[model samples]
Target chain A: MAQPLPPLSRRRLLRGLLAAAAVTALPSPGGLARAAEPLTRELPGTGEALPRVGLGSWITFNVGDDPVLREECTAVMAAFFAAGGRLIDSSPMYGSSQATIGHALERLEAVDRVYAADKVWTSSPAEGPAQIEASRQAWGVPRFDLLQVHNLLGWEGHLETLQAMKAAGEVRHLGITTSHGRRHEEVERIMRRVPLDCVQLTYNIVDREAESRLLPLARERGIGVIANRPFQRKRLIRRLAGKPLPPWAAEINTTTWAQFILKFIISHPAITCAIPATTRVDHVRENLAAAREPLPDDAMRRRMADHVRGL
Target chain B: MGGGAWWSYRPEDLLMFSPRVYARLFELHNQALWPAQLLALALGGMALVVLLRPGPRGTRLVAMLLAVAWAFVAWAFLWQRYAPIHWGIAYVIPLFGLQALLLVALGSLGGGLRLPGHWSVRRGLALGLFAYALALHPLTALATGRGLSGAEVIGLTPDPLAMATLGLAAAAEPARRAWLLLLIPVLWCLLSWLTLDTLGDRRAWLPLLAVIVALAARLWPRAPSPG
Candidate 1:
């Protein structure tokens, strides 16, 4: 026989707990600024000052069942902002990244300063609404700052909804994105026809296919460019492994292979920001260095490109 | 997974000049499990609540809760970028959390401990403490340096060794320390996850072996019986 318990709704307790957790998750004003501190490299966008370095949530923070890692990853995010960094990009396909961001940021309290960007990766009309809602819930924001169609995930009708979101002020920006090398031409074709504000794709030192058309076209269209995988899946590390750091690499304040790669990506005038995701505090520190100072000029960019290509 | 092996992964990695991810995401979520994904998280949360006990159950419950949300977030946002990585650990956290509440609910109406009103700062403190433990995990990974989305031993799967190590470390008062045993499973999940997923498939297999070692150690005979 068990003792009788008082009457109270467990759901209410959960809601209360969630609310409390959310409050706990929200960063302090200083902590929020601190979180964005590392990402303070502002890119000269169409008009607004955007952080030159941002975080990519494609794969780093998503470790199933490792809530500890998620929290650590969230701390890494806080550390990013603390280091003058800002601009984090995520999408629906990047499972639970949005949710993780919400969970982690809910307690931080000062999350408003941080750029909250995620995507809707869907195709069905109903699915689009649900995804946007889900992303909103996961992000814990009523509306998103930038709601993109993930990898061109739900390009047609969802973009239509995005257009509405932009019109109604539910979102500040709307666009389509892709990452495959072979999809460049197709990506280019769509960019030509679509009313887009931003473009994302892989454009690291070793993989320079985007430079041929997508990048140049972005400049022509006045689209703000965001670079991703500046390191090419850490291929640069694999490339530069066992090799000494270049003498000139340190000239731009690059200490590790991570900075060198990130610097190279943002060097191009067309790029607004380069988002490279990392879970380690050290890597975040290294990546933030790219946004701190001027990137290598075109001449240096060419030399770096050639250097890595040769490697 | 849609992207090529090179740098063709991650939604943010691509330029969305004329993006299509919106439509694609819609198609993906509408098919079947999208709605359930959120529910799974809820259920997983519930499981954690149910499984966590004041003595040994309390810590294990908390560990499971931490594992569930962490894994769900990881699968949703980072590692399984394209789809949900369905596994027992993934669902168990919330499942057990909810189950715990259910037991209390049934046990209470049918006769149990009286429930407390509004969660006070005490619960908040507990959460903060739990979050502290979660935050420390990456340090373990960072110390190892091999920590990444795919690093083994401390993922969704429970590493027996990690659990035992954690269990033994907290073994002074097995009741209060039993939850430490959960580290074994959490570490095991992390270790096994290394091979199953990673920043990319190209990551070295070192974490895989580490996870195996952790699991073996957990299975080793010991005084405390870690569930």
Candidate 2:
């Protein structure tokens, strides 16, 4: 049986209340020292200080009308926002993800904070604007923060619409996105010719193909780069599971492999943010923690890449 | 259209179709052909009734109904709809067509549907499975928190048809002949499981489990048929 302790003094009670408030005020920690101000990267064109970590809604948020799954996703989004995440990326190709996002955002009362990013992925040029409109309605947003041409699908036709939308203030920025290193040549051609504001492509420690050409070109063109598949869609993290983090991971202030890999991607000078999709609240906490501390320097980045490659 | 711009490709890009898109495809397919879905459901009910009352005429009717169901699902869902997003499904269309033809031949030539020699635990399990495929498969949406719009009905969708076929075949006797009927449904179960698993649908394992249970019931040693 437990025994009761001494009665609380007024001063001790006051101290306890103050400590409790402080603890409650601080963000939940999965890693890093404490809740530091989230690191931000400027959108090269607009100088908008977007958080270096964003959420992606690919397979993770496509729960379709599952109320339980939607509530779980809402909790995940709540954790993301509570940890200072901003950008939320989605594609119409991701099925019900946009609707799910809208639902979660409505419940969390987080619509205002969302830097909504979506894509147009249809083949018909005539259908491009309509697709964007449908996405807007699905998201329940009046305007999109970013609208990208998904995988360069009918990019030529869609670009014209995106440019008009940007000019008309319906979209804050316009860009193009591709993954799996597909069509880098085509993507490069579009970037060089079109006056675009951003480019998104897959860039993880293993899939370093983008570092060679796309990242450099985006840097050269002053185009903001959003890194997709930072964990190779969980392949990298799953591969590194149970493997110990390098002793030097402390230099980057990361405690988990998810943070280690996410830090590696966003550490690159060219990358503005890395949108890592996650369904779990704990993972969201871990991912958002990567943005709170100083990212690795170039040499550190190379060393981190080598460590994962060696693993 | 440009000299340097050829189509870009990636193996993972093939997996871009989300579970939402997969479910929405079924919803659209059902909605686009409304009354026909009712007719298909009616035919499935008839097949189950005929299968329970085993006779040569009833056997022929069940086979004919299954053949038509497979043919309709293949032409309507696989060839016409699923092929657009997944070009690889085009190759599967022929397999479905072949299954339909095989059923037609089996109905005309093979001995009438052989009911299990006697009631047993395996036979009871097979009946329960068949009833689940026919009745509960459509209510999966309710379980998954989806509306009726997303339901996949027996005889209307390939997964349920494959499931029901395995369940019915498990309940039938003459194990050697039942093996022939088992082939296509087993293949379909494996294929659908892989596709659904890729889409991150939890229901992916259902078909695979059905295959395993049916095979287990089939292999369960039966008491020697009474002379």
Winner by lDDT: 2
lDDT of 1 by residue, A116-148 (tens): 778777666568878788888877876777777
Q: What share of the true interface contacts does candidate 2 keep?
A: 0.05
**How would you encode candidate 2's per-residue C-alpha lDDT over A157-276 as one tens digit per residue?**
999999998889999999999887777888999999999899998888888887778789998999999999888776777889999999999988889999988888888899999999
What DockQ does each prediction reach against the true complex? 0.04, 0.10
- Per-residue lDDT tens digits for candidate 1, residues B64-146, read 44444444434443233333422223444443344334333322333222212223333333333232223333234344334
Per-model interface RMSD values are 12.6, 7.8
List where candidate 2 sits over 4 angstroms from the true fold: A1-36, B1-49, B52-158, B163-190, B196-227
Worst 10 residues of 2 chain B by lDDT: B1-10
